[model samples]
Target: MIRSMTGYGKGEALSEQGRCTVEIRSVNHRYGEISVRMPRAFMALENEVKKALACTLKRGKIDAYVQWEEAGGCAALPAADLVLARGYAELLRSLSQELGLKEEPSLGLILAQKGVLGEAVAGQPDPDQCLAQLMSAVQGAVAAMDAMRRREGDALLCDLASRRGQVAQWVQRISERAPQVVDEYRQKLKIRLDQLLEGTEMDAARLAQEVALMADRCDVTEELVRLSSHFTQFDDALAADEPVGRKLDFLMQEMNREINTIGSKSSDAEVTSLVIRIKAEMEKMREQVQNVE
Candidate 1:
């Protein structure tokens, strides 16, 4: 099944701790890679998220956004480290006594000390619960993205199939013209020989041998055969379960090689034109294959 490399999806999962929203966007790329953006709370699970994405996405530049809103807008208050604040306060009071400073160390002074104030961490959601929620949201988003990719892929495949048929027709035209090229060359050789010899008796056996050599040298049967085989392979790859982009690319290169060889060997105007036409179609298919996965 063909799949496209570009798509978008969004999903959400809710729990007692909060609501988590995950949105994913992907585009064509040579390799699989993913980046995530979310609140600091989810940073620890970035790798886990990537792994989950890789399970569904074969190749693409994926960008994900995650958002979490705590239930009821509840939050923890700033907390004080009592030991550190007490130690600092005591040292200040001692210094004040030794220096005969009139000022007494106040509660405000203790609270203002560095590291003395920090958030009273809220009860964290269970780790398992967080991971489960994350994976669920990720799966939902990826499923939606895959649906879009499949739809786009079906459309692209239709276009590619039509162009592939055109290429096949061009190949067939070249095949039909190949044998005639040799026969025409042999006939021209005989006419030229008769004119040069002023209508004298020509050696038919020698002419036949030379014509055979020309036929062998100019034959494009092998190239057409290989080209046909590649077309079959291309169709098979399209129906394959794995990503078919690279496979299609390699087959296209092989097809190019065969068509070029046919063009060089035939030396026929019509065959040459057909080769060029097939190559144009090949270029178009290449462009489309780049977006396939």
Candidate 2:
């Protein structure tokens, strides 16, 4: 199924120890790029997160963030090391008496020394359980993100279909007007030649040859035929189940090239206007294709 490169999803999982939240945001990119942010202890799981994301997404610049919050019941309390604090105070007092400084250090100054405090309040989480919870949250977030991508993809498909129809309409109009352009050129050439050779004899064969050459030079049948073929391929790629963004982009380039050539070769004002309209639709289609995967 088609998927858009832009979307957002968030998921949370609660446990007796804490609650974990995962949020993912993605934007259009030429290739797959994943960035993850989580607790320092969970850094080991970065490879796992990238593997999980790769299973579902094909292309985008994706950012994933994870947060963990501990409930009241799971909070840890801080404690000071009184023995270490006393040892430091005794050592400082002995040094002061030996140096004859006659000064006593403040309680706050003694407690501020390193190792005078026990371990930090918060303890390390159970690595295995935390990994499981993180995986679950990430899975849920990925599912939600896929849904949003699919929804946006549906809208893009509709827009592309409408633009494709417009391009087909313009191609038909150009085809119908092609023969008329040749006829008009032939008539104009005949009129000019008659005026230039008014008092001289004109060669019928030479005039016919000149008209045929001019018609050949202005012929857009080959370009129109190739353009129609490219349009068909574009539609087929859209209906495909796999990633078709790159394929569609290449087809759009080819289609635009053909349209530009037709405009340059066909001197008729009407044909030029039709080419302009087709090019405008092609540009819009190109922009939309950038978000497809």
Candidate 3:
């Protein structure tokens, strides 16, 4: 099924080590681009996260945010380096004595030194163990996002279908009006010639020749035929199972080309009006196609 390129989704997983939450946001883009943001500890999994997203969300500016909260009991405890703290205290005392300072080095000063207290390395969760939970959460978020995109796509499909049908009707109107334009022009020409000649008889063969020339000059049969073919292709694209945004966009361009040709060939007001309306509808469909995937 088709999908829109804009959506939001979130998923979470809980384990003995921690809770992992993932949120994904996507917007329309011409190409597929994915970015991931996570803690430094999980940097190794960034590629995995992007791969997972790209597998489902094929075209968009996608951003994924990952948050990890260690379980209450699993949280890493800060460990004090007693040896480093002692060394800092000794250095401070020696500097104080050398400078003839009256105040002693406080315990706070020693503990505040760099590397004195830090998170225990052993307390960190294993990345291998966390992969399963992370992937599960990723899959959930993708499913949610896909559902939203599909719903939006359905709405797009309906709107496009309605506009396509309306354009086809106008094309039909133009085709019906084309033949009358030449006949009307012939009548107007003959009347003008009669008025100028003051009752002189007109040449029937010459008049027929002139009308034939006019009809040949203003013929839009070929353009209308191509437009009909483009409409059929547009319908097929909408019913397609895969991404057809580019295909639909190309068809819109082709339709516009045919409509422009029709407008230029005819001098009739009704045909020109129909051409204008068809162009307007094509613009709307073109804009909507940019969001399809």
For every model shown, the clashing-pair count is 0, 0, 0
Query: Residues 110-207, candidate 3, lDDT per residue (tens digit)?
Result: 87899999866434567778999998889888999999999999999999999999998999988888889998999999999899889998998999
- Native RMSD of candidate 2 (Å): 3.4
Write the residue-wise lDDT of candidate 2 on 1-293 in tens digits. Answer: 57799999998888887888899999999989999998777788888988898899889999999887775545666678989899999999999999999889779889889989776565556656688888899999999999999999999999999999999999999999999988888788888988998968778899889878988988998998998899889989888887888888899999999999999898899999999999988899999999997
Compared with the true structure, what per-residue lDDT tens digits does model 1 show for residues 185-282? 99999999999999789999999999999999888888888998999999999888788888888998999999889888877788888888888889
Which 10-residue span in candidate 2 carries the lowest summed lDDT? 119-128
lDDT top scorer: 3
lDDT (C-alpha) at residue 219 in model 3: 98
For candidate 3, give the lDDT: 0.89
- Score residue 222 of candidate 2 by CA lDDT: 94
Number of clashes found in candidate 2: 0
Question: What's the TM for model 3?
Answer: 0.87
Better of 1 and 2 by TM-score: 2
Spell out the clash pairs found in candidate 2. Answer: none
User: How big is the positional error of residue 182 in model 2, measured in Å on the Cα after superposition?
Assistant: 0.9
List pairs with backbone clashes in candidate 1. Answer: none
TM-score of each: 0.81, 0.85, 0.87
The local lDDT score (0 to 100) that residue 28 gets in candidate 1 is 93
Model 3 alpha-carbon drift over 4 Å, by segment: 73-95, 110-124
